[model samples]
Target: MSTGFKCRNCGSNEIEEDNARGDRVCMNCGSVLEDSLIVSEVQFEEMGHGASAIGQFVSAESSGGATNYGYGKFQVGSGTESREVTIKKAKKDITLLCQQLQLTQHYADTALNFFKMALHRHLTRGRKSTHIYAACVYMTCRTEGTSHLLIDISDVQQICSYELGRTYLKLSHALCINIPSVDAFDYLICLLASQYLLERI
Candidate 1:
């Protein structure tokens, strides 16, 4: 934009505002009268995907250069995952394991609580998440008296029975949970007579 205002430096009547370059300049004298004049106007357009934001979000605290403020690649630990990601993955694995075992939502929620307790206590460090999650589910079953077998969880996820037992024991001790011993007849019923078999019979 050409202005009738004269250049303060050269005293020439050739002042121009360059919106594209974001500067007010003396065209003839090649002197910058003002700088850091960022254009704030934005036009919104509708697209099939969504409403498109044509301009970048500028921070109000930024003094110059139109600095944008937002999160980029949230990372923690190994830089590939954040706390939310770990928790989400744990929940997904627990849910999938619960589904495989045909357990209820209440059981799944109980297992998730166990997992969170383990996490808070730092019992999850240097250990496999799936193992801890499976242990949590097993503990849930034991506490709720749901008659689920640790072997069933191990079978569905291809985990070792010993590892699940170890994790179960570790979680129980650390969390101070006192689950009573399951009956031998309960094991026999679960092993010899499956839910499907009982339904069929």
Candidate 2:
């Protein structure tokens, strides 16, 4: 004899028995339908078969089936060490490039953060690390109101300006970063200042 019980919350018939909690829960809405009900017998039902089976429920955890977790071919260390190494290397590269470009420390840190985001998005795959670093710096400068031009970064990195521009565009589009337009007056001011300093020294 079976008694029909409907969930008061969702009125769902898909109820599951929680033996540990001694409660009947609605699987649909996760509401407790019946509580503190004493169960006389627990029957284990085999999956893919309609009839109930009189056997103990074997846990995959106890059977050693779910013991080991792996990352297939991508496991480098135990956990997260490989990812940390990649980040460290990227930071070092960015720092060096920033020093070469005479960027301030704030801009360097900002560029490092952007490079980390690009790495997380897998945008650095199949591309040279130098190009990614250069692009990050370029984008950071543009977004932070700095006057560093793409040609200036390309000249310092000894890479083609076209390649740096392409990578910058790709990074901007992939990351959805809205970089502000470069002010022509900023460039003119920088050039004039540099010429004056050169003439003085």
Candidate 3:
């Protein structure tokens, strides 16, 4: 049985097996070729009960194992909480801005969607969230054929008018969003409203 197998170390076939210890030894280099061979079967027999049983066991070698979930339970829970907090805050700010500007529900919803998109694109980086939010509202008004100048939005949001304009331009170019030209009537109406409010003050 040992003659067919070659010693891996010395390439010798002079192998000897010790049945008691279950080890096959290479006689040429005194190296162990194989050890702890399972050569016997375990039998269970009942003498007077007239019952005999035989069992065979098998095991498989595994290359590796994997887990289903990558993140821990606490990590996933905390991440969900953080996301919810951010969304809730954004919604509150957007709603307040819309109310202050007296925007209709339709326009408010459109602006909210635009703000969410800008958040998703990370366009608000290194700038106040309020600025991005105001820009979205301004863009939404323009898109909906309503006139709201950058200065008007900046006044409402308390952001610098020039900074808000630059932010809006950056967002429009980066997102490839094309807003329609403001209608002449929209500007006229806004101007008249501002003059009317000024006269009242």
Q: Pick the candidate with the highest lDDT.
A: 1
Higher TM-score: candidate 1 or 3?
A: 1
Question: Over the stretch 1-201, how does candidate 2's per-residue lDDT look in tens digits?
Answer: 113677786576766664433456554433446766554576655668454433233234653111223368633223324555676788888888999888877777778767766765688999998989999998888887776788889899998776666677778778777678656843454355455546756
Clashing residue pairs found in predicted model 2:
none
lDDT of 3: 0.62
Residue 53 local lDDT, model 2: 38
Give the TM-score (vs. native) of candidate 2.
0.52
Candidates 2 and 3 compared: the better one by TM-score is 2
The Cα RMSD of model 1 versus the native structure comes to: 25.0
Clashing pairs in 1: none
lDDT (C-alpha) at residue 70 in model 2: 35
lDDT of each: 0.69, 0.67, 0.62
Candidate 1: regions farther than 4 A off: 1-81, 185-201
* Candidate 3 ranges with C-alpha deviation above 4 Å: 1-76, 182-201
User: Global CA lDDT of candidate 2, please?
Assistant: 0.67
